[model samples]
Target: MNAAVLTALIALVSSVVGGAIVAAVNHHYSVKEDLHARRLDLSVDRLSEAYMFMLLNLTIDKDKHREYQIHLANIQLFGSPTTVSLTNNLMRRQAGEPVDVTTGALLSDILNSIRNDLGLDRIDTADLVRLNLGDEVDLLKRESSK
Candidate 1:
């Protein structure tokens, strides 16, 4: 082969190899980022469902209990470490365990942890108070009486 032609071929091969390496690296990172995003989305959905179930006091209802348990399991699977810990504590408190914090306080902490995990602003514990309308209160009283 002519010296000049050989040099040109070598340069072309080097360029092709370098380009492939860059493309592969970019693809690997893209896949990682996509997986991370999907996991975060799932975490958000599970947390929201579980939080709603807690807020509605539906976890106590026998019919809804299984669904709530599923949500809790999903939360454990997808939540950050702090979120998981707080959720476990909340469950323990619900089970009549001697957790030091009041139910409302523990709920607030769990909400704050979830917010932190989802990159939202933390809410004040006092701001997390539950409000029930007269009918809702009456319904709860009636249900508890049963």
Candidate 2:
């Protein structure tokens, strides 16, 4: 091939190769970013499920206990170290083991740990709210009075 034509062909080839490489790299990173986002979403879902379960139930029946156990396993799997520790402490308290903090406080700590894991700002435990209905509210008040 003539020198000028050969030079033009080389330039075209280099550009095509460079573009393909860049596209490949971008696709790889995009896939990785999507995977990371999905995993984070799953973790958030699991944490929310566990927290909501805690909020809605005042007492654990057989089915509720089973559900709680599932949540516990998920927390252990997907939660941060602090969250796992807090959850373990809550479990210990539930099993009649002596723990330094109240159940409510432990729960708040767990929530804060989860928030931290999800890159959210932490809130005071006092700002934490639980929803309770008639008898449940009365029971909680009576317990607090004791």
Candidate 3:
């Protein structure tokens, strides 16, 4: 019957359209997810570089002082607001301009920003100490076994 053939044709066309819609939606989501993942990776790398520079600065290595500035600049470009704020707080303290923020609080803020970037729950300073201690204990056990 022509009616049956017409019905089948309509069904086929509808299915094709639906499939195309689904494929387009899927591709869009996949690209979006990949972009998001890349951004997070970039953020992590920038923040880590900044932290390394901060550590290097602690040694008072004049040669690395310029490197420290470059690293911090990279962080400023890609890092979240919290990361920038922590760097600003430390820079102020380093300049010896009498920061209202305590050294302890500044350090804690840096750690918290790092944790947040890593998608971790915010932890108190005591928890950070405990985390370090746990790793130390693992090292101790390994040493004792050796």
Best candidate, TM-score: 2
- Which ten-residue region of model 2 has the weakest summed lDDT? 136-145
lDDT of 2 by residue, 7-87 (tens): 999999999999999999999999999999999888888887877676676577887788989988888878787677877
- Scored by lDDT, model 1 comes in at 0.69
lDDT of each: 0.69, 0.74, 0.65
Stretches of candidate 3 off by over 4 Å are 92-98, 101-107, 126-146
Model 3 RMSD vs true structure: 8.1
1-146: candidate 3 lDDT, tens digit per residue: 69999999999999999999999999999999999999878877776766655533444478777887787677677666765676676678779867554434444555566778788998865333222333554322232234
> Which candidate number would show the highest lDDT if scored against the true structure?
2
Candidate 1, residue 53: lDDT: 71
* Candidate 2 global TM-score: 0.80
Cα displacement (angstroms), candidate 3, residue 67, comes to 1.2
lDDT of 2: 0.74
List runs of model 2 lying over 4 Å from the truth.
113-120, 135-146
All candidates' TM-scores? 0.77, 0.80, 0.70
